[model samples]
Target: MEQAESLALPALLAARAARNGDAVLFSDRKASWSGAQALEIAARRAGALAAHGVRRGDRVALLCTNRSEFMEIVLGCGWLGAVVVPINTASRGMQLEHILRNSGARLMVAETHLVGAVHAIDAQTHALESIWLIESGEGGETHNRSGAAAAGASVAGTPAAGAPAMREIAVWPLPPLGEPLAAPCIGDGDALAILYTSGTSGLSKGVICPHAQFYWWARLTAGHLGVVPGDVLYTCLPLFHTNALNAFFQALVSDAQLVADRRFSASGFFASLIETRATVTYVLGAMVPILLGRCASAQEQAHRVRIALAPGVPGHFQQEFTERSGIALLDGYGSTETNFVLGGGVADQRAGYMGKLVPGFDARVVDDNDREVPDGEAGELILRADTPFAFANGYFGMPEKTVEAWRNLWFHTGDRVVREASGYYRFVDRLKDAIRRRGENISSYEVEQVLLSHPAVETAAVYAVKSEFAEDEVMAALVLREGAALDALALIRYCEPRLPYFAVPRYLDFVADLPRTENGKIQKYKLRETGITTTAWDLETSGYRLRRT
Candidate 1:
């Protein structure tokens, strides 16, 4: 395996395309493009962007779905030495405005249906210079003139008939320009991406992932996942996420074919797997439960999938999934701030551990003071990679956040964990999500894991809420399996013998569904918001009480 420093992403991709021209590289539900064809598309898109005055280091905001166009824009930006800012589809007026303004994007490429929203926000933003609709039509042709005005300008009356509107630019579909613009002239230290955090903490911050950081992650993940030429890497996670882009790089660097989807679909996942002949896929924990809920068939077991890199897998379902699907599922632990810090490799596939830290990376459990905690004790998981390669440059445009996260020269992950005797790390919970009651630290992840083991429980999120006693208390929001129902008392009884008195949730709220991030991680922050004031259930006297089975 080649080291991260020795490889440039674009060069590696070009080399692969040259060798495997005819291999299928990307596929959606409608069409598939060969490696050679995909590269050509990227080249053309890059040329088109350049033609539109997009230069090296320019920020291009991509607000589109999970399609070939998204990949083209990303790769094309790489080829042009431009930074790609992928906006979440879920973002609306203000959120979209914040990202576009903060990124200092010169141009935006959005889908036709979303043009109205963009136009609504574009009037208040000054940094956006142009807008291109991916699905343009006669109505969408006037997008530029459709806006109220530039920032601080007022719109008085309706637009005059036949007045000139925003120029509708054609989608440039050509091969990359001459010499691929010298690899965008970036060093290992240059910022490559400005990925906005999902804003679970109330304010979204752009994480500055530099070239060397991304390269390091891509190289290690590709090697760890055993990506190779002619293999089809399936990606259904949104390209806006580090997971998708990281997997994209893994496939690109290894000369492997890529099959992308607009989004992960429980109904369409197996079909897409067979359609694309995908050899490897990255699955989130939320996706696993969704797939498990679907009825199993022999067809699902017949797909070409060999490996499933599913992160955040709870303890009980790990074995069940492997037994049923005949696919090896490896759970890893990582965050957007830290790319692929710890993962189970081909050599080691433990049941409930996130494997040991990778070479050149150091992991330790630390206390609030940043002192190393003794092994086997749960504490904050702090990790740092060797030198400047594996670590990110900093949070983009936020000096305070960057300094806070990188305190003492180590990135504080905010996740709590305990190191086992076998060198494996067991995830306990997030430090903020941990429950503190009467001076005892309770892991929400541990409680949720135990709750998931209950045959009736489909999903669970445990968090802390202010109690009437003026301290925090353990509260649980649960989703029961289809056709299964247990009252609140029944659940408490079920957990009585399984958990310690302090760990058992005093309050329980049953919901039809839980909110999730685009990558399928449970939005515990949302649950915490709704769960804090919820008086739906009473432990001492409630209609929904669980009885011993």
Candidate 2:
């Protein structure tokens, strides 16, 4: 397979179009597009964005779910030299406001169903000047916002009474395609997207990814998965995530086809794979166990899927999953802020270990003071890229965080790992106060803040506990105020609107006091050690369900 002249999105699209214009490149529930058609769609989307005052270097926020428009907006922004900020569809309350404010996005394109989130955000709190709402199954016309009403575009209803009157920002149907804009001279280092990642001790930070990081991500990932031309690559992960986004690049760089579903459905997973003729697929560690738990069916063995980029799978389940489904799971390590830095081909992986460091990237197991630790000793895994623009530039609009994470000339992963004498790395635990549940990164500090907001709660300590699915579960230890009474269910109810459904603590413990240090700082490690005591309130057994909107 040949590579593009450069790693820029425009160059990649142009080269792919030139090589095989008629070959299908992308498909979702909305539509499918070939290489040339995809480029043309991107050009037209760029024209529409430019007509709405989105210029080069300006940020455009996307709050839609998995759809062709998601890819269109992303590719359009890249082609036009603008930056796209893809917000998590589940984002709400303080997190949503912070992203909109921090990104400084003047124009937002969101699904109509999720427009309530925008209405909930006070216009004064965000930089949005306009919102283009996309209705279900309908891709808006190619006209400007001014002409949208006349073109029969549906206008969004006014905000509900008592809600902030967001009259300052205009609401229009998804704009029509404008005149096709030509690609500019984009470089490998140009910002492609800003993906927000949860911070350990603070709010989430936007990771400024350049063109080359994804270029290397796709090239290396495709090689590791052994993707060949004409192979069908399918993923059910959300498009806002780096994994699914990088899958698109894998198809673009190699002459393969990409099939992205709206979301992962455990029941229909194998059916969809068979229908899409997928030869390669992706799954999270949590997903593997769910699939294995289901009763054996013919569909599991009927698919042609030979390999899956399955990360975080329990070591013991690896062989069981392959034996049941005939698809080998390849365990690897990568993050939104980094590329495919570790992992290898299917034939070269240890059961539970993250594969050895990939070539072109440097990895070190270091102590807390940044000193290198000997093999078999657990330490923070820090990494550096050998190639230029192969990792994220840094956190956008936050220089202090950028320096802190990228200090000492290495990007700190904040993950604890131990390297074996043979060079394989075993995962230990997270050094940062972040929790991973259902593939979503939850900030423990943010959860603690929410718990503390309740008037009855005087102190709160939020941390992670092991879930049955081999992922982290949010657990909170709370201290009530004097003469105050609050049940765990009531606190969860208070948190439902204030936090994402997943961030709400599944296990809550009401204590007289929390463990603290001499300086009065909370010692979270001690709390993590005594996870889910018998007296703790368990939401799973409480019969109350969280509404995942």
Candidate 3:
């Protein structure tokens, strides 16, 4: 345990399996697994990938929710020294296609419910060779139309030149075990995964996370959360994000139990905590405030959860949540591209301020020209690591972007923060066109691009409106073509299939023209300040439901 400095993921997993092979590592409502059992099972999956021609450094796309198989697939890919590309399951149409093509994923493993989205994709464009389906255990027919098949049916890949003979193989309905193969020599700096984060400039960029970065994330966070052996780390956040993945590794570092579900349910949050007897967990964005706002239940003060790692909870809500739920909330600051950079415990944390910069990171707040702003003045937050591999290597496959981001020897966060004279950083606003709804980071640029693709829209300006929850809601103001008329519901229907549910504009305004600067730049800040106009189309009140089909 003392020799943790040089260890990477595979080395860590191998050590744990040897140390406590039969010990319980996962204990959720659905199933349970021992460390040894998980290792052996995931090893077979590694062989399966190798058998299918996947090799070290190969990209394997994963479209999964919060299933145990998600972790297994990560482990399997790590065993083969392959880089896993964990895409957001809510991603549909071009958003999904962009990640597929950008990552150049050779193979993809998706849940049965999500396979349709992938099935509709033009595989050749993404260079996808094959796909394996994970049966959802919910009784339903596979989406393949060419033949009637059972759970393990094989469907042809979308026809295109240079595309592999694509087969939708249902190879994961049940866990398969095979002989464990020798793992390749992988180092701490080796790339573990490529996670696509919403770019402020509107394009999604892949953040390359190295294994050592993950190791430090786990170690540092475990120390912060006071995780101990036999403690239960309950999480329901999707595994695609760095937040949940950090908690995942924290459980491993502490040799604690993990209870995870596919997603968060505000109503069921307390009951699940009691069910798993969770000691520590995570609550991001709207979760803590929403839970505090929920109708009081008999189970509110009855759960075993003692501490919750709340990244950005409002101070008032943090106090209220503790008084109501008997759970303490701790605030911290980090992003997909960085680990826990600044944070403190409940006692040290002040309301409305991000804690001081943590060890292993050098932090600064700088103006546009990379000059450090005076304390108490708003500026962009930037960071440099004191330890190697503590942050992402770069945005994957984006050399110019990488150079731009690391310019002036610091990673520009594009987040406006003010370093108070007291040294606590206060988040002011985002300096980019992005929206955070619930737990999802949505690119306003991407949403605008989708809206412009519609025949009726001549120009679109997308921005964030304040949500009842702590996060923001997406709003779009559109300039319709001359004599063009698009119904709100019709536009909603168009977006349902193309954009993720969160990215779909909840409020739309058809305007004659958007406010522009002298340089003809659409002044989104003006629209954002104006917020939902009286004449704007309100999708929620209009009874327009998201259609999955």
Candidate 4:
């Protein structure tokens, strides 16, 4: 019985509470639990993180949003062996003081309106040491970034003024569900959760993971989206990333029933996937063109959703979003330091590749001298796995960026793909988001899928700027469709016939959004540090001339 990949989240919640202790599993818009009430709320949230002085490999952090007390502090920091760290509630200042000082964590639960972005950081730079909140307005108190409540605070212990340089941190409140604590001696390669990376070219590393890398990312993404047992997986993407925290470990090792939501609402996404009867769901890649630029409703083919996984979608919006939402999106490839290594299952999917290469992992693609690279050419993918710690056990306190991204024994994945001798793969771009111009090379994901197949484009991005012959130029940042107008020279003559006249967009802008990263990605290094902005638009100073057709 100890084989769920060497069990870890406190023996995988005591073997799913000894085989489905009253089934259910988890839900969100407030409640619902089961598997013996999620193993008795992971032992009363591991006895309220050991009465606040958290222990095992410590590091707590969790800046809330997406509730059920953020999955009971990630199952009470994996039933008290401790490591959680979730963050990205749209972080803040110096990337929330470099993730609370590179996760030295020291107890941070958050969400009484995000503890005023942790009392505006700088409490001697970080390693927090207090804050619990989660109560939401007045009773949980701690407000201050002008949303009121700081005069001799009203709940817990307080001491939280403007956490300046050397001290005063405290702030309490979120405690109850205390005495239950049992499951301790953990393993399955320990470290369960550190996450972090949407650094989008800098700072955010963290990774670590282990606990058999989220039990092989919920047994290879619930066996590539055919997640079974009582099905229902939904996810409005943002349990602080790793694709909605591995869709809550693929509905806890597939006894399936997750529902999460606390975000992504393209007009309440098909009435919350028809009131969560969600037969496996989850999205990303500009949420499939923002639910295919909204408007077609009758809740877009109503619900009982069938399939979704959807990693970076856009192979012509995956068959017009599975023919306008009878679900089925698929596509793959993974990364919070890998697992679900590539994908398959909706009868081994293909349209827009990323699959083939899963059997206990080991990939290649190479070329910036790490060799390999031949099949269909593009390079840099790497990988390795064969299971052990499954994949990520490095980059926490960044030991030289985890030996420069796991040096030779592979794991690089700075991404760039193309394998194809029918073994699939495809995805070309993000080898630091490639875009050379004039000397060609572009693919900012194929010019943001030809500026998201135009029709008043609602969310493009496509980057790279520097050119004055110094190289890179493309640029884009769009977002139109709400009373849509579009004309940055008619979106560069609709990307000069679907791109390649030097990948069209010689700078555009139009934004009302797109600088994402709290798990909706697209932070193209803050639009390459807000580069050509004198109200953008340029195209070689408006003279426009692309000929090569």
- Model 4: lowest-lDDT 10 consecutive positions: 151-160
Candidate 2 lDDT score at position 485: 99
Global CA lDDT computed for model 4: 0.76
Candidate 3 ranges beyond 4 A from true positions: 1-5, 142-175
- CA lDDT of each prediction against the hidden true structure: 0.70, 0.88, 0.81, 0.76
lDDT of 1 by residue, 135-238 (tens): 53424445446652332232322223555443332332222343333455556666667887632233456777766667767777876787777778888887
* lDDT per residue as tens, model 4, 211-279: 878877887788878788888888887787677777787777777778797877778888988987787
lDDT of 3 by residue, 341-390 (tens): 88866676787887888877888999899999999899999999877787
* TM-score list, all predictions: 0.72, 0.94, 0.94, 0.30
Question: What does candidate 2's lDDT look like per residue over 302-413, in tens digits?
Answer: 9999999998999999999999999989889999999888899988899989999998889999998999999999999999998889999999999999999999999999
Query: Candidate 2 clashing pairs?
Result: 141-176, 141-177, 142-176, 142-177, 143-176
Q: Give the C-alpha miss distance for residue 76 in model 1, angstroms.
A: 1.7
Instruction: Itemize residue pairs with steric clashes in candidate 4.
Output: 34-37, 430-433
- Residues forming the 10-long window of minimal summed lDDT in candidate 2: 142-151
> Per-residue lDDT for 12 in model 2?
91
